[model samples]
Target: MQFIDLKAQYERIESEVRARIEAVLQHGQFIMGPEVGELEERLADFVGVRHCVGMSSGTDALLAAMMALEIGRGDEVITTPFTFIATGEMIALLGARPVFVDIDPVTYNMDPAKLEDAITGRARAIMPVSLYGQCADMDAINAVAERHHLPVIEDAAQSFGASYKGRRSCGLSKIGCTSFFPAKPLGAYGDAGACFTDDDALAKALREIRNHGQDRRYHHPRIGLNARLDTMQAAVLLAKLDIFGDEVDARSRLGRRYTELLTARGAGSTELGGDAVLTPFVHPDNVSVFAQYTLQVPDRDSVAEKLSASGVPSAVHYPVPLNDQPVFHVGLPGEETPVGARVAQRVISLPMHPYLTEETQLKVVDAVAAATGLAGS
Candidate 1:
């Protein structure tokens, strides 16, 4: 079985995707083509934001957000350690420090309770990643940022279609960024991403920053980088938009189905005592896009083995905490983020896609129970 099954999604949109690509080719403006602006406008409307700045990749979207805010050189951005390295990597790249807070054990997101204590004088921004497609407690995070006079950037790479308290993920913060990596919820054919914001001045700044700091052609206003999103990639996204809403609904249903079946089998409940497994936690006030339906399992390595043996695919989102990474480590052990460190060792992501079938989910869950020696329970 395929882990992500991109081919399945592609097959559903092949003709429309080809048509969009053809239109891009006919325009002969591959670099900054009309399709690029069209995609930006459509995306902005979808996210309920004033503007959307398309960029080269999610990493560039993040880097440009920092540049637009002037967050660099001895500044600190508070975040969690249990996410992909890119979130923290961008902060460290700007000669800024990434101060970490512990994550909630259930949500695997930065704990809003511990957030304020990490704010020092140098804290310029609060970057909270919406891990595994569920938004972090953004309302609480934003309140803390408002009190501290700090900007909040949502690393919303995994949560483009997610919602928090009636607001979209990318529209919930000062600046939000999302990816179009082929594996993400709203993916393109190649590398691309976007930054969303309601603030006009910040949006204007981000537009210039992505285009070599140009206010106009040959009029350089500041130092910047080449981070423009490609026209072809934009075209691909435009086609995907036709079915995006339905796909999101399908993903949510699949996520709930996984939880129901696992709960029925007592696989992810405490009834068996030793953490048979743990399901992804969705807050009552929000909706996750289910970018990945992750679960925490004991004896994770053995469970992975059985899944593989049963031809049921699985993967780990992050096996180690970002603070423990060798390149960024300051030779200090990451004892502060105890929950993040503990969960990193146990969390595993099952195959999650809008097209996931009931039979496949059953097979995957049965493999899990068998792997954990709970098949008869």
Candidate 2:
């Protein structure tokens, strides 16, 4: 079974995607074409934001947002170490420091209780990643940010369709950035992403930043990068947007099924053995898009090896915490990121997608169970 059934999703929206691409080809305005603005508008409306600035990629979207907020040398951005490197990479790229924080073991997201302690005069923003597919505690994070007068940027790359307290993922912060990586919840044909915000000035700044800091053609207003989203990709996203809601619902149902089936089989006996295995946790106040149906297992390496031997494809969202990564290891003196370290060693992602069939899921579960000697339990 495919880890993420993009093929199935393509089959469902083939005609719409083809037609949208055809229109882009016919128009021949590849750069900053009408489809770009169309997608930006559509995305803005979908995310309940006043503006959406499409960019070259998710990394660029994060960079653009930071640039718009004037995050520069000596500034610090607080975020969890359990997320993708991109979360901290963007801050480091701007010559700013990424203040790594521990995650909440259950949610695998930045722990808000530890947030205030990480902030200092140099803190410019709080970038909380919506890890896996569920959002971090935005209300508490926002409260802390409000007290410190810092902006909050939601890294909603894995959680575009997710909801937190009745608000959409990308609309839950001062600036929300989401990826359109082919593996993301709401993916495009290729590399693409968007930044959302309610503030008009920040929106304008982000637009300029995406286009090499140009207010208009050749009118360089500030240092920026060429981060414009391709018109063709935008067209592709527009087509996918038509059915994204249904896909999200389908994914949620699939997640529920996995939970029910796995729970029924018994967490330890179903797969990876029950010794210290933890199921994915979803908070009652938020809904996950289930970008990855990840779980915690003992001896992750051995479990993955067994799954591989049984022809069941499995992967890890992250094997090492960002704080421990060689590139971004600044070493937070006197701070111990215990939760991030522990989760990094145990988290493993299973095959997850809206189109993943029950039979395929069973095969995967069975393979894991057999490998971990849980088949007879």
Candidate 3:
């Protein structure tokens, strides 16, 4: 009944996790430890990238990537407004403007068709989030970026293990960043993140930016932040990486099962009206990690309340579009990006993890059926 069942994952990898951490502890090189480099190499290889720069957190990873790109005041970064605030926050923190673009209703990702219209003279980059563990349409987005001569940054925080058209998430764009927040698909014990790229200069710059701009000991060349990932977290991630491929398969199977079960109960997209539930639509070219297994439900507040009353836990990935948030709000109330604003109000997530049992999953679906007035239909 736990939302993520991290305890179960820990139990499965306890011995390896302990061994890795013990090795780090014995070495006592907490900062810039050997484990960090090992994890980075493994991750880079897994993602099919040339370099992986470990960072303190996903936010810092995004920050460092932007800094490496030289994004700053008066620069405008085009990005979707449907994602986590961190996507926009990083740009704002660097004194850059985050120009909001609406998302596609089906995928809930930035619509590539909208990209051209949003580009302006100051547009410096295009950042697309792989929301809910499925990558955005990278090819189309990259096509647009290429024409505009802009770099594309993939915010792959929820999609670390996902694949798009035979390519991995973090290797799909000019710069890709992912988080190891405890709940993410490939999570660590604590906050951690990494940036991936094939550009040698950008790779070197990212490494330096994460460590006070120091290319070598006490030699600072540019302004930067202390954003290095801790050795302990690197150890945990290394242990998890050993079993991550299997976990990814499990997550995909469970996600499909959830959709099938809901569809059978007359609560699926085919029955999208009244109390029917609208499940996630995965593109044929993409493999999702199902980080949240989210769905769109009408009367979301009441449905959530009923699920809670039935002892079934549910959560919302996001309740408001970024453009509607107080800190980022712009345009009139009705002028907000239409699709994202509407979708945000209806999205809700169920308890999802690789270890989730079918028995437990069935109960969750039954609870949803009851809450949506499709229990016997």
Candidate 4:
């Protein structure tokens, strides 16, 4: 089975997608066309934000937000190390330092208890990534940021449709940045992303930043990058946005089904036990979009190998903590982030998509059970 069933999704939305793309082609305004503005408005409304500035990619969205906040040389942005490199890379790109924090063992999200200790006078912002389509504890993170007088930027790339408390993921922070990387929960056909904010000034700054710091044509107001989202991508996203809510609901149902099946089958070995393969945890106050349906499995490598050999595709969300990566490693072997380090070795993502069939899902669960020696149930 496909790891992510993009083909099925496309088939479901083929007519709408085709119509949107056709409109874009007929308009012949490829760059910053009408569809771009249309998408921005639609996204802003969906996120309940005053503004949504579409950008080139998720990475660019993060960069644009940082630029708008004037986060540069000598500044520090606090974040978890158990996420994609882009989370920290954006900070480093701006000559700022990424202060690594550990994640909660259960949620695999940035641990709020450890967050305060990592903040220093140089801390400009707290960027918390909503990993695997589940939001980090935004309320706790926001409290800490409020106390420190720092802004919070939710790296909501994986959690576009996720909700924290009563608010949406992208609307919970000072600035929320989400990616449309085809693999994300709410994806476009190609590279695209958007930044959301309630603050008008920050919104204005982000718009300028995305267009090479131009207030208008050729009017450079500040140093910026060409991070504008293309009309084609915007068109695709607008089409997808129409059905995103339904897709999120379908994914949630599938995630719940997986959890139920795994629990019923007792898919944990005697040596490992049922607790060893902890399913994805959803907070009582939040709703997960289940972007990856990742699980904590002992002997992750062996499990993945067995699944692959069994014709069941599986992958790791991240094998190594971002702080441990060669590019980010600063010869600091003693730097301790126990939670991140531990989770990095155990987390494995299974095939998950809104269109995943029951038969395919059963096969996936059976593979897991067989791999873990818990297939008897």
**Candidate number achieving the greatest TM-score relative to the actual structure:** 3
**lDDT tens digits, residue span 1-377, model 2:** 68888889999999999999999899899999999999999999988999999999999999999999999999999998888889999999999999988888788889999999999999999999999999999999999999999999999999999999988999999999999999999898789999999999999999999888999989998988999999999999989999999989988888888877666656632232337556788889998999999988888899999888877888998987888888976566213687777777788899999888889888887776676555343
- Which 10 consecutive positions of candidate 1 have the poorest summed lDDT? 267-276
Q: Which parts of model 1 have CA positions greater than 4 angstroms off?
A: 269-274, 330-332, 375-377
CA lDDT of each prediction against the hidden true structure: 0.90, 0.88, 0.93, 0.90
1-377 in candidate 3: lDDT tens per residue?
A: 79899999999999999999999999999998999999999999999999999999999999999999999999999999998999999999999999998888888999999889999999999999999999999999999999999999999999999999999999999999999999999999999999999999999999999999999999999988999999999999999999999999999999999999988887565333344579888899999999989999999999999999988889998898888888999987527588888788899999999999999999999998889877452
| lDDT score for residue 325 of model 1 | 90
The residue ranges of model 2 lying beyond 4 angstroms of the native Cα positions read 268-274, 330-335, 375-377
Q: What would the per-residue lDDT of candidate 4 be over residues 15-67, giving only the tens digit for each residue?
A: 99999999989989999999999999999999999999999999999999999
TM-scores, all models, native as reference: 0.97, 0.96, 0.98, 0.96
* Stronger candidate by lDDT (1 vs 3): 3
| Regions of candidate 4 where Cα sits further than 4 Å from its true position | 267-275, 330-335, 375-377
Question: On a 0 to 1 TM-score scale, where does candidate 1 land against the true structure?
Answer: 0.97
Which candidate do you rate higher for TM-score, 1 or 2? 1
Those runs of model 3 whose alpha carbons end farther than 4 Å from true positions after fitting are 270-275, 375-377
